[model samples]
Target: MARRGKKAKGRPISGWVILDKPKGMGSTDCVSKLKWLYFAQKCGHAGTLDPLATGLLPIAFGDATKTVPYVMDGRKTYRFTVRWGVQTTTDDTEGEAVGTSDLRPNADEIRDLLPNYTGEIEQVPPSFSAIKIGGERAYDLARSGEAPEIESRIVTVHSLGLVEMPDADSAVFEAECGKGTYVRAIARDLGRDLGCFGHITELRRTTVGAFTEEDMVPLDELIDVADENREELDEEAIESGAKARILDFGPLDEYIIAPEAALSELYEVMLNDDQAGRVLAGNSVLLRGRDAPAFCDEAFATGHGRLIALGAIDQGSFHPKRVFGGKG
Candidate 1:
């Protein structure tokens, strides 16, 4: 049998899109919406956010998707509301109430408890979650009436603070954490420490890696653009929106961020023609310039105003670890 290469269609879009995800929309659903509006050939989100959670969701299109792992590994900051006296199946408001209480802690007590969650700790994820048990999703097992014992794992919380007490029944929190740290689990544990059952009433991610609230765009606004450009988009035009402030120019240019922007923390070292050629051809090149590294694990390479590849520098030599070109 002769094997054949698969064909790809749709716009060859390549860039980063930060979406201010609205509540009730799954992260995948939000990415799908963005992909459809842009008509991109490929798209994916940096991280998964539960339907009950909202805020900064980074969506990468085409070549930008290659950098998603970098963003996912970066630190994240969140602002969440914990509703005391209620513990739920999922540890969030969307889940059914599993336990309740009349206990509520005051500001001094809450502040005292904040330090307990601020450093390295063993945290157990909620039963209703995306974690895999055997081959099936943990959430699926929970929905099917199975009690899957989720073991505790070590997670780092860079910082955790009590933002405010919105009401007698709720307390707001701000947490900046490393990868795999769940805000929902924090609420669950806090209630246990404060003598009141707790669950996340509301949650918003303020930051994810290098992307922040300032970079996010609302879904309605993006959809509105596709609607306004219907005449040019032809039958492929998105008409999901019936309202918006119409503009003569297409709004997409204003929203797209350069794929290289994802490597803002990484020092970019523009390679010469020779170095670029050698790196692209899967060969190592020497670094002798003033900008040459003491030694870095990786640096974004650029040539002729284009992202070339992610180069690995060691002992003043550069090697191409991940190529960014020819993504089509």
Candidate 2:
């Protein structure tokens, strides 16, 4: 007889969770904890936050993972502090100091230099980064002493300004940049230009795509609710008056943002019932309205406020690429 296939585990929960990641927790570890807490069958993060960094980390469960690329492509906002006297291997506090300087830049001097780093600029990512080289992670290569050569790439920095100079040793700055822009590289390059070798002492991501500071739910808050609800369930069971099932999610469902929220930036095409059915069946439907886009590289269709598919519009026809839970 043929061996049976392995059964899938956990609940088929699907949605987005904007985690206000605390310092000292890796992004992967945070996702793992969330998976266990929610008992979700699948979980993934939209962006990676360093162990030393903190702020908005969008966690995706189930089908929401299909939209991760869109979130990653969105603009990112960060407020980081640069320690002006040292340059570290990792470009942040976690690495050894490889260079030092006594010269510290004043506010006026830093202000004058901001324009050069803003808009489009060429940057060499920190050696200790997630960038892959030769099918191996750059950080791993750096740790193994392979000293990988990373090429400089063009990245957009929409805005960059000095927020304040906390002391002679550090300067706080805020920036809004496009994908692939590294905050560490900003500090490193700025320090080199100012003649005051620097590295990021503090880093915090304030926004990514449609997700913002206001959307974040801290890890501890979720844990607290999970524990409290479980205790209540146990007590009710002992009393033989169980009003709710232990696995019912209780108040935890409130934190799950709908998966369609991640696709807000994409062009929206409203589909009729027939269109929605066709789209859900992996078929294309003719867009009948004059308001319909002539052509679009990417667009999402929704029927009665429910996400149906993600695809492109060409010649007044909407093609379905990725179908979702919109078919009734």
**Which candidate number maximizes lDDT?**
2
Off by over 4 Å in 2: 1-5, 231-246, 325-328
Question: lDDT tens digits, residues 1-328, model 1?
Answer: 9998887766776788899899999998998888777777899999898998889999998888888988999999999999999999989977898899998999999999888898899999889888898998889999999999888999999999998987899999899999999899999999989999899989999898999899988888887776876554334344754433233334775688888878888878787888888777888788877867868987878765667788778888777788876542
Model 2 whole-model lDDT (C-alpha atoms): 0.90
**Residue 13's C-alpha lDDT in candidate 1?**
69
How far off is model 1, as Cα RMSD? 3.7
Give the Cα lDDT of each candidate.
Answer: 0.85, 0.90
1-328, model 2: which lDDT tens digit per residue?
9999987788787789999999999999999999988878889999899999999999999878888999999999999999999998999988998999899899999999999998999999999999999899999999999889999999999999889898999999999999999999999999999999999988999999999999999999998878767644577586997654345585787899877789998999999888888888899999987788879999998885567789999999999889986221
- Screening candidate 1 with a backbone cut-off below 3 angstroms (N, C-alpha, C), the clashing residue pairs are none
Q: Residue 210 in candidate 1 has what lDDT?
A: 90
In model 1, the runs with Cα more than 4 Å from the true position are 1-4, 232-250
